[model samples]
Target: MASQDVVYTSTENHAGFKIDVVQYQPTKRPIEDRFSVSTKSSNRLLLGVYDGHGGSHTAEHISNILPTALLSHPPEKHAQIFRETDHTMIRAFTRDHSLLRPKSKSSDWVHHAQVVRAGCTALILDIDVNTLIASYANAGDCRAVFYPPVDAEGHLRQTEDLNAKTPSEQQRLAQEHPGEDLVVVSGRLFGRLMSTRGFGDACYKLPHGTIGNWQHRRYIDALSAVKESGKIPMNSQYHAMFHTYRTPPYLTAAPEIGTMQLQKDSFVIMATDGLWDCVSSNDAVQIVRGGLEQEVDNLAEHLLHSVRATRAPGDDVTILLLHIIHT
Candidate 1:
């Protein structure tokens, strides 16, 4: 049975800094998106959002374990830090994918488990009060937008574009990979999935080995048979795109990382593609900045309500409104 929608809201405060969060599931699909806020110290904070594509397991697992995985490593340079963090996330995802492998399941069932082709995009932000530096890393389309303090007219100021690349940019990146075929099906990686890089999706990330040769042939044959029989409907043709044990390592978990100096009254917005799919970054910034000014404790809830009311039903929507209070 399809489950009902779920929405959650909460506030996390540390050393007078507050992180307002809202999580919403607009459709009946499982809430595959997960988020968490943690503090390394009174002056340092970490926030993350994981958007699962095939199922919630990968996202749930990342939500529960990624924070600790990150905290275990001490601070370092921006590039080194993001690289280390990405490796940690990849390891955690690989471990869980192996565990979730069903002993007797069919290829179709395994495909749905997110192990064969399921995965989640990751967006993480690290904030330091002392330096007012906000470092971010992005693996998929999940995005972060910054809204500076209001101007004389009370209009929110744009700090810079922290959002991820557009779909076209992602395709360009896919083509950059060696031996990736530069093939894009429906604007997704490998011509099948929306996210170009992320955790899990072993069939895409791992290279096909000796045993994978036969598996690859079987995979293509099965898909061909299914297509020829007209079993998959046109509207759902995307589902026919699954991963094969191809070599040369087509997909990756690497992230794009950068640092920005946060203005005194700056606030950062983080969310999954579900929310972005419906609401533009500019619209989200306006709503959230206004809410922050109004001291809206339910800002996350209000954002979800606006998204659900304004746009068509979307994927799981998760938003985090983080206000940095400089001491």
Candidate 2:
């Protein structure tokens, strides 16, 4: 049974399987999403949608290590791994420099895992009591959509966090740079290689160096701290200084790093760029609603079928569907 992002009068039945089909590649990878159901008081249900760019290396890296990364945290860590992983991911690009470069020793693909230059985007949803919080983090074009369920009447209702972007975000952009487009590109799935924010992408080659906020006050503060610490002499050779100090790598799709109070009528959908690029948030929500109302079987397959029907000619599609049954 699937529950929408609404507080329904009756109990909602919710259970789902994440699905994927990677096109344009010689090999089909197992889905990157990792879903687990736990009996803990929080009734932990972890669902992650990872979309990778350059190649599947980024996806594979997250698929293999994210579980371990989560394990590294004793639940008391409260997403500390998120930050550590942030550093761990960038440590490569910083240490090695050049995300577009074919990394060997430091690449997650070579030494530890078989990862490549690919960078990944992720959205994780955790279901705790009286709240179904979803973390929409990505360095690429993956996305998460929340849909609230309605009754036989076909009415619709959902959580307030459903809107995209925000006025504050616009204000923040204005504060940062006046002329720069607030929503650079459509922010649509297939447009920008790296979303406004994400995890593994390196500094993009642009006429201006404003890919995102990667080179902002945080960087200045970091540079100031490093300089003050006297790690290297101010007049030292540029090469030596660069070798000593470097900025952390960031995913194209960085999570808002948020906490939301989720109730029933909560349905969460996360998928890689392939799916989100071809499909819009509203379109995805509609498909789930339609599937549940009509056949009510193989919702994942139904989603894939719809995505295939609408997907672009050259797209690598992967999707992970989740329904938040109980808060």
Candidate 3:
């Protein structure tokens, strides 16, 4: 059975704004998503959502580090910040000798390897209260949608979902790895990861032979242990990926950045793919519009309820709604 949902609202930032956040985990596996909201100054508000796969380590780490990193840098440097953070995590994982030791016990090595392999999609929104500018940086499939003034008929803006499934993303991958038709198979990178850009996932980004050598040594050690104990051998999921791996750095952490000027009757919705899997961008705006028309108590919770009533999310769901009240 699914665990209890996490729901809350915050109005602690600058005046004329209310933020509602909700998270729902529908599986037994650890919730692999993380989110944050912080006030950088009287003028700036930062919000982030990370959707993790393979494990939650990368998402958790990014959640803790990214907000401060973004607050310290200018908008132009945000993309570089993301790449640097990802590289930092990769370096830390690769240099940890305690995890890479061939003679180490299986559980220890496996846990470390899993941490290295984990990756997460990121969506960050930086709102400037003074300028009314909302800047967003995104990698992977996490999304943000802007709802225009109620009088403006049928106008909505949203971020693109950057995954191997998108044609433009596929073309970019094809260009990067020429003649490799298998670079994307069935909407997944190397027929495995769906996200084409994000943090961590060292197995996809590391130098080609790095993971291969580690896997070979680890497999040998596992075989030896199995022979001695007559136990089933531990298998690494990336073995097949290593066979087809050719290029280094197949995935990236560089985010696509965008900006919008907020106005009265406007709001923004930021969510992980779990919500998008069941609700389209247009539908999401409509749901929020209906909620506002009815003067719902909590917009985010109301939206989440609508989603659950329509179709249950297969993965962890996180939603953030920012209600813009012009002063």
Candidate 4:
């Protein structure tokens, strides 16, 4: 198994403004999270963060492909881009599985299964300079928190009031599919994963039937072999112990997309669930509020430290802070 890098940091200039990103992976899980920031036509800014589980292939693939899809697709409707990306991911993973099935006896097939069964939760932010609105797409629990400047007295508002009004928190899910609401089986997401929607995890996303059931078993066996060989330490039994008991397509890649108007002297923080697992939304805002007053580079590090202080074993953590300087 590939070992994770301890920390990663970078800054991007989005339409002449800066967006800083930071990631910390204290565990040895291959740093299964990925992020991207891109621009188009000098006005549109696209930013994304992907948190992967089971494996990193899905997150890495989306981080590399989703931005290009957005840029090349017609701008008439941006949400459609996320749908297109989801469809493409399904097609790509299906094709890869088909090509490997014929050679299932080979070690290559096991490795391919490891990669194909990987899942990734995603959060995307699209900003158009002309409108001063930030469009967001979320699949799974990765979150985006926007913090307006504190009052002249130098105190930030309570977490509930700030988060209650953020676009990410207010967007309601329109009923469309059965699995849209999170389902828990034995405290695990769908009883196997932590996310209800994401890319990859084809074994879980497939319709419940003979073929899907067979694939699930195959994945479990492969994962066990990898773990026993010391290739990875991730617990495969939790996922193997449960099966989809409800309708077909127990998990989805469909993204929840919405928009938020930007305001000056405010900051938007996007991060993987790792951060939220320990820090509350209000606490996170307070931390960033202090960071903005001091330095941006310390924001990510500070958040990670705070999460660690909670004494909970942390997950792979990634933070993207966008200070709305001119938006």
| Best candidate (score: TM-score) | 3
What TM-score would every model get versus the actual structure? 0.73, 0.55, 0.85, 0.74
lDDT, candidate 4, 1-327, per-residue tens:
112434787766565455777787867546889998877888788889899887687788788888888777544455676666666655544444452545445565555555446778788887877776777777777888766634686553222211212333323221323443444434455445656567776655544346545554544454455442345433355344444333445556666667776776677888887777678777888877777777756566656555566655368889887776664
For candidate 2, which ten residues in a row score worst on lDDT? 1-10
CA RMSD per model (angstroms): 6.7, 11.7, 4.9, 6.3
Task: Write the residue-wise lDDT of candidate 3 on 39-117 in tens digits.
Answer: 7667788889999986687788789889999999877788999989888776654554335443346565444445456
Over the stretch 1-327, how does candidate 2's per-residue lDDT look in tens digits? 112211111122334323222222213433333222222334454556565554455566666666555543444343566556655655543333333555446433232222323345555555443345443333334565556643576444322221123344334434544454423235321123333343443322111124433333232222232232324422343332222122222122334545444455455665555565566677777888787779465555567566656554244555555654433
> Candidate 1 has what TM-score?
0.73
> What is residue 94's positional error in candidate 3, in angstroms?
2.3
Clash pairs detected, candidate 3:
none
Task: Pick the lDDT winner.
Answer: 3
After superposition of all CA atoms, the RMSD between model 1 and the true structure is: 6.7
Ranking by TM-score: 3, 4, 1, 2
**Reference-based lDDT, each prediction:** 0.62, 0.43, 0.78, 0.64
Looking at candidate 3, the ten consecutive residues that score lowest on lDDT are 222-231
Rank list by lDDT: 3, 4, 1, 2
Q: Which stretches of candidate 3 lie over 4 Å from their true place?
A: 1-13, 97-115, 149-153, 210-238
